[model samples]
Target: MTATQLSARALLLDMDGTLVNSDAVVERCWRRWAAAQGLDGDHVMSVVHGRQGHLSMAILLPERPVEQNLAENRAMLAAETADTEGIVPVPGAPRFMAELAGLPHALVTSADTGLARVRMAAAGLPYPELAVTAEQVGASKPDPEGFLKAAAALGVDPADCLVFEDSQAGIQAGLAAGMRVVGVGPRAAAHRPTVQVADLTSVRVTRDADGGLLVAL
Candidate 1:
């Protein structure tokens, strides 16, 4: 069978693991929370990626009062925003994103706008013009709301979108949105994305003669 390149009207991307390498900051915060809640950090980490803080809190500490989870989620968000000491762009991410500037692309992430801005700044990335953060969506990843919202914001059909995601929840969201998804990391490959790549470095996007975007890997 011949390998076919993906072509799309727009691109949607996940933030934390896909565009930015925030592993150290993420693990630190989640581990600290797990320690405080007397839960296993590894288990907690496994369920947290690509999820909103409140959602992750609810999943990890279900027995806690809803109010308590809300409060801690706020705290965790603040801590993550403040803890940008080790955050950086994922390998090939900066270059890939730089090329995407002026293109039809948006960041659709589980992180709220504030947290997204901080992390993007930490990673030295440009803020996307159309970002659909957690605050804008009725539901977070694992739900297609965010991705759908992004596609709408770009005035494109979901089928004409290409999403790059690094977490299972994110991959699932992209699939549910009816967009072609490119899994961008080791963990994402297990989710069976429509396309799988080690990282954004290998993927290339070019504008065709007809002004359409073409994605090749």
Candidate 2:
């Protein structure tokens, strides 16, 4: 199906595993945290992806106070942001971003502004003209707040936006916002998004004969 065939008006994209391949970087950071706490790092990172930072810290360091976990996780994330050697743009992500520029597109992510900037800069991707970070919304993915915030920022109604996400939490957020969702990445199918593609490499947006943009996957 094409995007023009549908009524979608805007595009909302996730940052981490979706637009940029930061899985290894994230896993490494979380592993350090786990080691410090004497828990399995891989296990912690597995539960952390697509979830809020504070939430992930809470899951991994349940014994620690929420504030403490938040502080530690934030610090670790800051360090990770500074060390973005392996983090790069996902395949087709840069081209996709370039194609979507000057259109109604927004980055809606659970990452805070600082870390988002670091990752995006490392990926050598164009910065979104509009963005909604974790700090901008009271609630994160699965709550619909982030996606809703992006729609609001774009001056588009929830139903008019099409979201591309890779995480269950992010897909749920888009779905909850009453928008169509396109899932990307290995774990995308778990979210049951409206359309699922293996990666950005499988999708493209083009203008149809009708002069409307068609998102093909």
Candidate 3:
């Protein structure tokens, strides 16, 4: 595919599959929970990415009470945080982050503050100073709240913000927030982001003459 250039005043980023490959820990904790719940681990995994643990649990076990999901989610978060054996920065993530120095960007992730900190630290990536974590949003991805909040916090119009995401849910949230999305990694290819890239290595960010971001994907 031909590379595409997109213009934006700010960038909103997702955490898990986008900047950090925490699948090993996520799968380990979630699969264990799935088994205890008598649900198929594979199917649970499908709905878990890009969502908060409680939200994912609610989706997989619709009949479960919100309180129950919330309780279980807390436990799941602890387990995932404790096990970072396979966590690593996505390819080119460190370089990509360095290029964003002094640029307008904020992390918008489903992981709460603690989990976000743990994962980013484990992956040896710099955490953005501005972040909208699960605790900051009333709704998860596939709902525009998180992205919209990030754009607002950065004082940029939603249309002028670009979102970097790797899951279907995150892509949908970005679009729903009226922002363009640069899907990263294999999973995002099928989500119909504004444009798709294999990883951060395929992305380049530069300042345009107007002082806005010029993102080449």
Candidate 4:
């Protein structure tokens, strides 16, 4: 494949499915929750990715009270954080991170700070110094709030930022935030990001002359 080049002043990255392959833990926990609620596991899985737990629950069980979803989400987060089995970095993630060293970048993930920390540690990936977790945002993916916040924190214009995501919601969020998106992994391909790569191994990043990023995918 011919590599497509993208230029950006800063990069915003999603955690799960992008940097860390936490599907095993996520599926285990969410599927258990689905079974408990008498919901189909496949349906539940469809809504859980790239969004906060409480939000996913609210979507899956709309009739349930917000308080119940919030409480359950707290428990789910705790359970996921405690279970690190099968967690690993996505292919080429370590090299990807190393390439971004000294560049402007921030993690924009639906996971809370605690969950994010735990998963990143479990995957053996370096946690970005700047992160906008669920707790830092008023809305989840598809709202563009998190991505916009990360861009602001990085002191980059939204239009000058590139987002790395691996879910439909996340790709929508990046586009809504007026940034270009690099969809990562199989799940992201159907969402129509600016570019799609099987994994970080298909990507190459370097510093441009103007101190921006030159990402070739």
Please name the candidate that would achieve the greatest lDDT relative to the true structure: 4
**TM-scores for candidates 1 onward, in order:** 0.96, 0.91, 0.98, 0.98
The sequence of per-residue lDDT tens digits that candidate 2 reaches over residues 1-217 is: 4432443568899999899999878877778778888887667766877877788777666777988977886797687778887898889998899889777889999988888998999999988989898889887777899888888888889987889999888888889999999889888888699988788875677665754457877
State the lDDT of candidate 3 residue by residue for 111-147, as single tens digits.
Answer: 9999999999999999998999999989899899999
lDDT of 3 at 179: 95
Global lDDT of each model? Answer: 0.90, 0.83, 0.92, 0.94
Answer with 3 or 4, whichever has the higher lDDT: 4
lDDT of 3: 0.92
Sequence-dependent TM-score of model 3: 0.98
Stretches > 4 Å off in candidate 3: none
lDDT of 4 by residue, 1-217 (tens): 6789999999899999999999999999999999999999999999899999999999998999999999999999999999999999999999999888888999999999999999999998889999999999899998999999999998999999999999999999999999999999999999999988899997888998988889998
Question: What count of clashes does model 1 give?
Answer: 0
Where does model 2 exceed 4 Å of error? 1-7, 207-212
Q: RMSD of each candidate?
A: 1.5, 2.3, 1.0, 0.7
Better of 1 and 4 by lDDT: 4
Across 21-71, the per-residue lDDT of candidate 1 in tens digits comes to 999999999999999888998999999999998888888777779898889
Higher-TM-score candidate of 2 and 3: 3
The positional error of residue 197 in candidate 3, measured at the CA in angstroms, is: 0.6
Positional deviation of 177 in candidate 3, in angstroms?
0.3
